[model samples]
Target: MTTAHDYAHQNQERFQQQLIDLCRIPSVSTDPERKGETLQAAEWVAADMRKIGLNNVQIMPTPLHPVVYGEWLGAGPNAKTVLVYGHYDVQPAVTSDGWDQDPFEPTVKDGVLYCRGSSDDKGQMFAQLKAFEALLANGKPTVNVKFLIEGEEEIGSPNLGKFVAAHRELLMADVCVISDGSVIALDRPSIGYSTRGLMYLEMEVFGAKQDLHSGAFGGIVHNPAQALAEIIAQLHNPDGSVAVPGFYDHVVALSAAEREELAKSAWTDAEWKEATGVPAFWGEKEYLLHERIGARPTLEINGFVSGFYGAGSKTVLPGKALAKISCRLVANQNADQIFGLVRDHILRLAPPTVRVEVRQLASAGPALMDLNSPYMAAASRAYEKGWGQKPVYERGGGTLPILADFQRELNQIPIMLMGFGLQTDGAHGPNEHFVLEMFKRGIDTAICFFDEVGQIK
Candidate 1:
């Protein structure tokens, strides 16, 4: 049998070309204009699965964008089925967003592939496909594999729950693997053991019926913008902890062992500050930066829009002010419950002069994977083989909502997160790129995972 290393050496160019082809689709699910592109990307993913000899490839339509599902159950009835989950959709990008080049046009610079979806999901998702190709070409695949790539993940995956619920039998698997996040720093293969939940909301404060001259109405009326600022300020206390009542009631405290493990990961506060270019860093007071980001819950004002001052200062009191807020929830916390508490707190804190209304934008439950599961052990060994280093177990500050949904719908099957990307890759921002070295390593890691999974029994 041809070894995985030999297959990788021979197919390196083909793997890179596939990622370039996937990046050129412009699959931005949030924009209406790119709806066609979203479906086209799904088609592209399906076609790649077919090219890899995966049977039963189908584009399952959703209310929004479609999901690409394919499976190769030819490993026989006793073989364990592994469901691979990833998204083909990408966050919207444009030249006005400060891209060094066209976001959809893939470019190779300094051994990095720069594009909109280069590192987020498209690049990671393509890695799994190439892994399958290598396994098939080498005649070494030992377990059943299924692919479930969706195009609406960037939009909160609003319809995925229903779809998964509808097709439980088809998606039933011993384990689910995801490769959608950054690895633990460069040269460290990481496994995401948990992800914080998300509750995104928009708060709007209303003052007058229309804009009024600041000189005339500044003292006479309560400015909605001012009220909005005050309300946001009151969300946290002087100590920098969120002030919402019952907000942390359900947050499970981290264990001492977990804290020690996190501390050993070589994350320095000075390094974080330098990376963010921030003068200083502050969080919930006592925790380290890694803990603050990964284990602790946080509330952030994602965006705020109030008054207008385009070129010059316009002395006008805006009639309305809006703010987009999101909370990263820790383990055991519920999204709806936390959102309710925050909304009530804002309403109670609002002055009688202005009316405030809160709208829930999106929400997803927190997910904690069992680190002791067989699949995680298999993934660890796979990464060790591929990267020549033992994998580090870690958690993410951001949420992948469908992860929780997959567990709930699939009878609590353990999900394994084994990805190849780095924080410096710039996933959601400008100059987003994926390291070619990591990309090749990811393919090798995935191919190794299949062999390791087969050995588990």
Candidate 2:
């Protein structure tokens, strides 16, 4: 009898091809033009799930896009069921964003495959399906399996919460395993114990109904552009800390031991500058580079649109200005509280000449897994068994709303964040790619994890 590991290796070529096929679809959730492509991706997922022997596969509809749900509950009553979570949606990408090849076309160079959704999740999610196929084909799986792959993750997973809430009995499981992020290094497989929360908001400032001539009304009236700039400037202090009155009141400070552990991450200022092309390093003066990003909360202006930014000189003071801001919250901090504080601050800083409006776009609380649980230990052993390397425990700066929901609603079930992609994969950025080696490792790890968890009660 062939082992699942051996079966996974034997089918590596086919797995790679299927992943490329999935990545070929431009399932960009935010693009209205790609709605059909998104739905096509969903149907493709359902078909593939059925081909892998999974039953009850369905293309569930949502307000915006569809979610692909499937399961295989052949395990005995004493066995555990693991809910696998991943997203088929991808961030918008184009050639102009600095890609040497077609963003949607899968291109292989050396040992990696490049495409828009290659790493940000299509490939990673594909690995999950292939892993199960290998396990079920090689031998009987000890634990039941279910997949909740969605198409709206890039757009903040707007409708998944309602779906999961309304289908509690249908989606019930003992745990959820997600492979949506990246590891600090390929050699170092990390399991995320915590993730930052998000609070996205939109700010609009209106000066006058119509455009005004800057030459004529330059000094007389306040420019909404200038007003917006001034207001945002007050958001941060000289020391690079959020200046909101209650922003840091509930921030969870990292313990010294925890800080020391995170400092062990494979991050260097040179690598950061080389990747981001930033001239210098800057952040909260008190915290280390890793601490500021990994554990500490942050306030950032994602986008800003004001007066004329066209090609030539147009001396027109636009009637309105708009800005999009986002905040990443840590432990003990609530999104509602942060949104309220930031919105109130923006409104109070506005001048009488401009009318300001703050809209709370979306929000989700942070998640921290209990690393001491039996399931995490099982995950650790699975990694060691699969990759021959001990896994590192880490906290991710990104937010996974579904992880928070699974943790909040399914409080008793454990959630594991065993990401298999590498940091250089460029997940949501230009030239995103996936390492074929990591893809194999992800499948092996998933196989072993199922076997390990099945031993538990």
On lDDT, the candidate that comes out on top is 1
Error of 2 at 172 (Å): 2.0
Per-residue lDDT over 98-121 for candidate 1, one digit per residue giving the tens place of the 0 to 100 score: 998999999998889999999998
Show pairs that collide, candidate 2.
none
Off by more than 4 A, model 2: 20-37, 89-109, 114-116, 202-233, 273-281, 302-324, 347-356, 426-432
Q: Estimate TM-scores for all models.
A: 0.85, 0.83
Error of 1 at 245 (Å): 2.2
Predict model 1's lDDT versus the native.
0.88
Give the least accurate 10-residue stretch of model 2, judged by summed lDDT.
404-413
Mind sharing the TM-score for model 2? 0.83
Residues 71-157, model 2: lDDT tens digits? 999997679999999999999999999999999999989999999999889888888888899988977899999999999999988
Q: Looking at candidate 1, what is the lDDT of residue 151?
A: 87
The alpha-carbon lDDT assigned to residue 339 of candidate 2 equals 98
